[model samples]
Target: MCPRRARCFNTTGPCSPQHHYMLPPAQRLPEARELIEMDRYFVLHAPRQTGKTTPP
Candidate 1:
């Protein structure tokens, strides 16, 4: 691993220039999984496209 990256993972001292551009994932993965498990509804819509179907 890049030396700067190891340090930044812990949010310690300023990391070297190599670490500047990384953007973290928008939400931690575990929360996303929980939301998927609880999903109770969904919708599909079409305008110019002519049809729709939902699976059983």
Candidate 2:
């Protein structure tokens, strides 16, 4: 099997969940991965530039 490397930080806009560290404010709070894994519908709110689009 091929090994995988950590994703790099983005310099432009929002980042993928795998690159959460790039947007520290959007870290795994309220258990983002867990919530998503549940397959339930939900929503999140945050100010602009606070990683609102990155699942914070």
Candidate 3:
């Protein structure tokens, strides 16, 4: 197992709560799971620097 590290601010790439101070991605888009489970097509529209690229 890997040792837990202190969280810090992330300026590039994906942000993980375990290693970076960030809002939970799942909470940002609560409906994503339902939409995905339904197997429907959808688009995520957001400005740059937002967590839009993060995995659902």
Candidate 4:
């Protein structure tokens, strides 16, 4: 793992849906609500190693 990337290894399964309650707003950043609500057309872009890839 690169030193710059956050450690995301899961001992069990991927993150739980209820985990959202524990996430701080700033930590999640721009948020996904507005993007889905407004029916907006846009792209979400970021540099590599920035957690931009969606879970499979």
What TM-score would every model get versus the actual structure?
0.20, 0.38, 0.54, 0.32
lDDT of 2 by residue, 1-56 (tens): 11256666443465665653554543645576676799966677765555556433
The worst-scoring run of ten residues by lDDT in candidate 4 lies at 16-25
Top candidate on lDDT is 3
- In candidate 3, residue 47 scores what lDDT? 75
- Ranked by lDDT from best down, the candidates are 3, 2, 4, 1
- Residue-by-residue lDDT tens digits, candidate 3, 1-56: 22467776565676667776677656877997898899987788977766666542
Minimal lDDT window, size 10, model 3: 1-10
TM-score of 2: 0.38
- The segments of candidate 3 whose C-alpha lies over 4 angstroms from its true place after superposition are 1-11
Best by TM-score: 3
Arrange candidates by TM-score, descending. Answer: 3, 2, 4, 1
Candidate lDDT scores, in order, read 0.38, 0.55, 0.69, 0.44
Clash pairs, candidate 4, are: none
Least accurate 10 contiguous residues by lDDT in model 2: 1-10
Overall local distance difference test of candidate 4: 0.44
Better of 2 and 3 by lDDT: 3
Question: For each candidate, how many residue pairs have backbone atoms clashing (under 3 Å)?
Answer: 0, 0, 0, 0
Cα displacement (angstroms), candidate 3, residue 15, comes to: 2.5
Residue-level lDDT tens digits of model 1 in 1-56 = 44643433323334334553333323423354455579944444555322233111
lDDT value for candidate 1?
0.38
Model 3: per-residue Cα lDDT at residue 38: 98
Which residues of candidate 1, in runs, are more than 4 Å off? 1-27, 40-56
